[model samples]
Target: MITKYLAILRMKYVEMFAYQLSTMVWMFGTMVQPLITMMVWMNIYPDQGESFVLYFVALIMVERLTSAWDVWEMDRQIREGTFSYQIVRPFHPIHWAIAENIVYKGLFLVVLVPCWIILALFIPSLRLHLSVTGWGLFLAALLLGAVIRFAMSFLFGILCFWMNKVTAIYAMFETVSLFLSGQIAPFSLLPPVVKQISTFFPYRYMIGFPLEILTGTANSHTLMIGFIGSFIWAVVLIVIISLLWNAGLKKNQAVGG
Candidate 1:
């Protein structure tokens, strides 16, 4: 099974390389939103401490790393009847999505690091301050965030088996997530009620918690709470995805087989 996954990963890397130019363009497009947000916020609060810039920089990295474009690909496969073949394959279809996710992010990170380094040279305030323990915790939070977000997205994509408007539903989700996940602004900067509410929702754990850890803003208590919340959400989502995948497969068999 490990070998099979490795092969899939290698295939994805080759596929990505074939479209390197387009991939670079897509990477640039992804960077623009965060860059613009950083510029506007920096201008508005020029006196804000270095932590402010560091938070946004971490936000950009988290966004790219946790991105799940597999939802669109899953939708396409379902719509075009390509998923039928995958259903009968020896391995599960989720492995393909996982491979694609890893490959895409790995390529984006290759481009992101050098670009970020150059930007950091120009903007001295972008430096991050983290202790050794903080770095370890931040990475754990990031891994959990990525898995939870990907599972949520995959479950949503599975809805295509029963509904024709998954994209519209996904758009609605994105609208809510943008504010709740700290894409619009740091969760710390949100209103008191919103900030408290964000803690209960999985959105903050998906992006904000990791950013907070990276920026040295999350203290010990908050870190414990955030990690626990992330773990609970990850388990819930994994179960939900398993149940949905089984149900969706049955529904597909009835409708198409």
Candidate 2:
């Protein structure tokens, strides 16, 4: 199992770096949204005052580290009935997904980190201070966020077994998570009711809560609350996945191999 997992990681690593130019392209491509945010915030504060810089830098950190849409891969497999090979394999499909996630994110950082340094140089005024402990906590929160997002996305993808096409449904889920997760904007700036509602959902903890903690915007009480929130989401998602997978297996019908 360990060897198989390693092989998956190795293959993903090789695939990630397959084209060095493509790596640069994707890095710059992903930078657009964050850069646009920086521009808007910069315009809002010409002299580099206010939360613009903090928000901009925090977003930069967020985009550089974010992963997306392994659900598409899962759906493709399920749709084509190729997932049966995975069932017969010696490992869980989640391990393969984890390997792909790790390899791709690591590869992305190779491109992302340098852009961050360049961003700091170009906009030195927008630097967000990240202490070592701040960074440690931030990384933990981000990891937890990734796990939560992956579990949720994969769960939705598995739902394709019972749906017409889960891409649209998964997309809706992603969109909701994006807003509720605070990817589009800071939750603090959101309406009080919105914040209240987000707290009850896993969306906030998936990305927003972690980003808040990373930016040191969360007080100790909120941080503890966020930790508990993220924990519950992870556990609940795990249980949900267990139930969904068993049902998906029972209902699963195949076309070809």
lDDT per prediction? Answer: 0.84, 0.76
State every prediction's TM-score relative to the real structure. 0.93, 0.88
Runs off by more than 4 Å, candidate 2: 19-27, 41-50, 125-128
List the pairs of residues colliding in candidate 2: none
What is the TM-score (0 to 1) of candidate 1? 0.93
Question: Candidate 1, which segments miss by more than 4 Å at Cα?
Answer: 253-257
Model 2, 1-257: lDDT tens digits are: 77888889998888876776876787667657766766775676588544666665666566556555678987898889898888777777778888988887787677667766777677764465878877888888888787887888888878988886788888888777656777666776667887888888988877777778766788888888888888998999999998888889889898697
Residue 89 miss distance in model 2 (angstroms): 1.1
181 in model 2: Cα distance from truth in Å?
Answer: 1.7
Tens digit per residue, CA lDDT, model 1, 187-213: 767888888888899988898888888
